[model samples]
Target: MVSTALQDLFGGKAAEAVLLALFHHGEAYGRSIARDFAVSLDSVQRQLDRFERSGTLVCKRQGRTLVYTWNSKSRLASRLRDLTGVVYDGLDPQTKEQLFAERRQPRAKDKPVIRR
Candidate 1:
């Protein structure tokens, strides 16, 4: 039987994608997550809002964009990050590759782009 663990863990596939984007990259915005997952921006934004309200995430204004990251000060957020890490560790390589195709997002002003 095909396990629906991912959807069960995240409540929905779209929500899982949004969380995984943040987990993989440490931060993300609604539009970027939605575009990466091919889900609607509104759906991603709703998930973001839900997480933010639950104290699992915090968002700061980067100009007009609201960038979300785990709420470091909250223990619940920390535990959730750890859980997400475990789930991420179990994802197949192909799934990770596709979900994280774009690592680029609009940088905050004056954020230096480091080249390898």
Candidate 2:
């Protein structure tokens, strides 16, 4: 039973591709997601429905478009977001260090008089 569940979780390549697409871009509609994988809308919607049922993705309605994004409440999705953060940090050590060294560099608020 455990092996079967594990296989179900990791076996779907389409789901992984869809998640990667949404992870790189915050939110996307069905058509945009379909275009990312070069798949039909029906196939994309099917995968999205499965993800939604599994609680790994969530959808919101915006005008005529139904936008889908990673569900923050899902443990898997949260871990993926954390992994992305670590990857970004590792990609730019200097930038990460500088940002951590100074959270936000404040500028002088006073305005100086300009002399012609």
Candidate 3:
């Protein structure tokens, strides 16, 4: 069973998406997460700030960037991950395969990788 507070932690779809991303990646910065969701940097940062305050996740400043990580100590992160896994599982086979392949691939740098 989960607590109401835990349910509130992943209340919105947007927050759930952020939690899933952190769960899968282990850690990510605002720009990377924003790009994944196709949202603005300000939007990601604001949501991350709220999530940190809610104690569902943790954040730390690394040089110029604020990196977000799931509070692995939280039981809520585990439950949320389970829910995310179920949702992913229910997706179409092709989508599931693409997500599986993408998850296996190394994450790209937050910066553009332009080759000359």
Most lDDT-accurate candidate: 1
What would the per-residue lDDT of candidate 1 be over residues 1-116, giving only the tens digit for each residue? 12236569777766787667888888899988888788889888998999999999999999999999999999998988888778788877666666675547687776533321
The Cα local distance difference test for each model comes to 0.78, 0.57, 0.60
Tens digits of per-residue lDDT, candidate 3, 10-114, equal: 565455446546655678777776666555777667778887887767888899988888777888767766775565444555443333334424557662221
TM-score of each: 0.82, 0.56, 0.62
RMSD of each: 5.7, 12.8, 8.6
Poorest 10 consecutive residues of model 3 by lDDT?
1-10
lDDT leaderboard ranking: 1, 3, 2
Residue runs of model 3 more than 4 Å from their true location after superposition = 1-13, 93-116
TM-score of 2: 0.56
Any runs in candidate 2 off by more than 4 Å, and if so which? 1-13, 80-116
Candidate 1 Cα misplacement greater than 4 A, ranges: 1-4, 105-116
lDDT per residue (tens digit) for residues 1-55 in model 2: 0122222554754554465446555676677766654557786778878878888
Candidate 3: C-alpha RMSD to true structure equals 8.6
Give the CA lDDT, 0 to 100, for residue 94 in model 3: 49
